[model samples]
Target: MTEPSTMLAIDPAAPGGPEVLVPVERPVPTPEPGEVLVRVRAAGVNRPDVLQRMGLYPMPPNAPTIMGLEIAGEIVAVGQGVARPEVGDKVCALLAGGGYAQYAAVPAGQCLPIPQGLSFVEAASLPETYFTVWSNLFERAFATEGDTVLVHGGTSGIGVTAILLAKAFGLRVIVTCGSDEKCAAARALGADVAINYNAGDFAELAREANGGRGVDVVLDMVGGDYVPKNIALLADEGRHVSIAFQRGPRADLDLSQVMRKRLILSGSMLRPRTVAYKSALADSLVRDVWPLFAQGKLRAIIDSTFPLADAAEAHRRMEAGEHVGKIVLEVP
Candidate 1:
């Protein structure tokens, strides 16, 4: 079969809103060494994509300008040194960019076989949230079995994955969602307690739910005022990992509390990491987390899907904050 010279992809023409995500024909990217060219079937939309469209998260040096971070598809071609994912392999990969396209050239190290019993749409939803949650909650926070974790934005994609993974790993999970309905959804996903932030104080509720010892770990996306509160809710030697700052980046924290509690505060950005680093993360996921999917202990929670050209509408839905889980784009 002849490969197409050009493919349709969503590009942010300028820094602005969802309207900026325009479809246009672009040259197909050729995989470099240790990479594979994927015929994208589905892509996951994430909060960072929104920030990138708004010019808040500028493309890293040498990264593609396309908006998607994760994609599920088939390997159509491979670059030199790519051994495992040969042509015709079905995979879902975490990408630095360029996933919002008909095809994407991704580092083979970032690719993983689509889990058994999952569709391309569900596979697409896994990489970004799963990688982030795994890197932060388990790796950085060092959360282990029997630990209790408080996850903010419990109904969001990252939160849902964190809840499921934490529960699967034998940790007690508490969550905070914006509404009562979202709180209920979190509980159904295995959260031991779900705090409706609009109805109650999340820090207090988390502490109360954890026997007044506070949680052993916190996955916080909301910064600003949430920073101090998150710090307040951590038990001694607790870890706090920040992935995104939906509220605001700036925070005035009480260092005294951090010092007294011996808390660990850390965060990571996935896109800029070296391929070797991401490859290691992929290995960890396949070895430790993939089995959970086959056992029916882990699953993707999709809120909605849009056709490739209607990416702007998908972005609108994500920004509206009504969706409970991930928003996906189907590529033809």
Candidate 2:
């Protein structure tokens, strides 16, 4: 391996806008116990990364933190006691933080072999969204075959992935998107019903489509005004899992509605979870979902890729709500 004193990365000194993100050279990290030093081939751009950059989601009391949550790379060096993945293994990891760099240290257990027939760019897009969906929607929400699921952001990377995976598991999917074209895109991606949230009431549409039974589950990212509507749209014993709040988090809840429906309200953030816990989520994905991906039955939805130096542009696109799938940064 070539020795380099520093790595090129996107850094945010003060968070306000996309312009705040600037390229910088930072010291390369070394792997600690149970970790592997990865030569990053690509890193995924996610909403959380943007939030972290703006100081909304601070970096665990650590300043000057590198921004990223998932990466695809080759294991260039392994720390002591790590045996399964040796040097030169191509993998993707669910990072706690610090994925936007030429090299980043990741826990060995959080790494998974890249799915067969996937490029580094595609692999980089899977870890964060897939892990969050599996853990929250399937595991926590008890979403099962024959159930009906309402995904709030149909054109999004998470929404598309949820629709596909839910369909793969024999579940019915309804998604909400901003435009008719985007709605059509969601339908083409396996959404049973694509409602234009700008023009239609998704709660009513989803309910009508389900024959007034209401959806069995809702995977929500828009949290403000949608909260009550979410409660109204759920079937008895239904589950609502929120992974983000694009509309803001403060909302009034009606306890009576929650009681009447017997719904489960839950939220999960993948980054703050323990390595061991996240490793288990990764294991389940490898065991259950990897086969489908390998068979070409399920794959990632990539919206765009930008050079690492153009991260600010990537964040701008994301904030504009113009992107439909995952945005990525090419390391080389």
Candidate 3:
């Protein structure tokens, strides 16, 4: 089969609002050694994409200027060293960049076979959020069954995945969302308690939900002022894993509480990690979490989808923060 010469891609002509994400035709990229060329079917929209569009999250050196981090597609061509994902295999990949196009050159190790019974749209939503949650919440924080976890942004892609996975693994989950509707959505997704952050203090509610001992783990995406509140919400020797700082990056915290409580504060950024590290994470996810999908214990929550040409509108919806779960862009 012959590959196309050009494909449509979303490019942020100038760093600004969603309207800047303009569609343009560009030459299809070739796979490098250890990579594969994917015929993209769907690409997941993430907060990082919004940050990238604002010029705050610059593309890593040597990555494509296009803005997408995860995609579900068919492998059309394989690079020399890649042998496992043969041509025609459908896969969802954790891409460092370039998933916004109709064709993407992705490292083979970052690709996972789409789980049984999952559509391309569902698979597309998996990589970025799952990888981040697994790497940080499970691996780094050492979260386990019988423990209590407090998740912020409960209706978000990452928060929802964390809630489902934590519940499936027998952990009690508490979440905070901005509205009552989102709070209800989080509860329906198996969160033990959902607090409307706008209505009340999440730290106090989380503690009450955990029987006054505070939670065993906290998955925080809202940083800044949330840092102090998150620290206050943790149990003795509890872990705080931050994946984003949508509120702001700077924080003023009291160290006395951290010391007395034996709290562990840590965070990670997924895009800049080495291929070997990400590949290992992919392997771990397949072995541990993929089976949960087959059993219906885990599922993707899609809020909306748009054609590739209307990616600008998709970004606008995401920026509004009114939608729950994941938003995706369909290649066709």
> Per-residue CA lDDT of candidate 3, range 139-228, in tens?
999998898988899998898998988988999989999999999999999999999998878898778777788888988899999999
- Count the clashes in each prediction: 0, 0, 0
lDDT per model, in order? 0.93, 0.87, 0.92
lDDT of 1: 0.93
Candidate 1: where are CA atoms >4 Å away? none
* TM value for model 1: 0.98
Cα lDDT tens digits for candidate 1, 1-332: 66899999997768998888889999999999999999999999999999899999977788898779999999999999878888999999999999999999999999999999999999999999999999999999999999999998998999999999999999999999888899889998899999989877888877887888888998989988999999988889999999888889999989999999999999988888899999999999999999999999999999999999999999999999988889999999
Candidate 3: stretches off by over 4 Å: none
- Any residue pairs clashing in model 1, and if so which? none
After superposition, which runs of candidate 2 have C-alpha atoms over 4 Å from their true positions? 61-64
Kindly indicate the candidate among 1 and 2 with the higher TM-score: 1
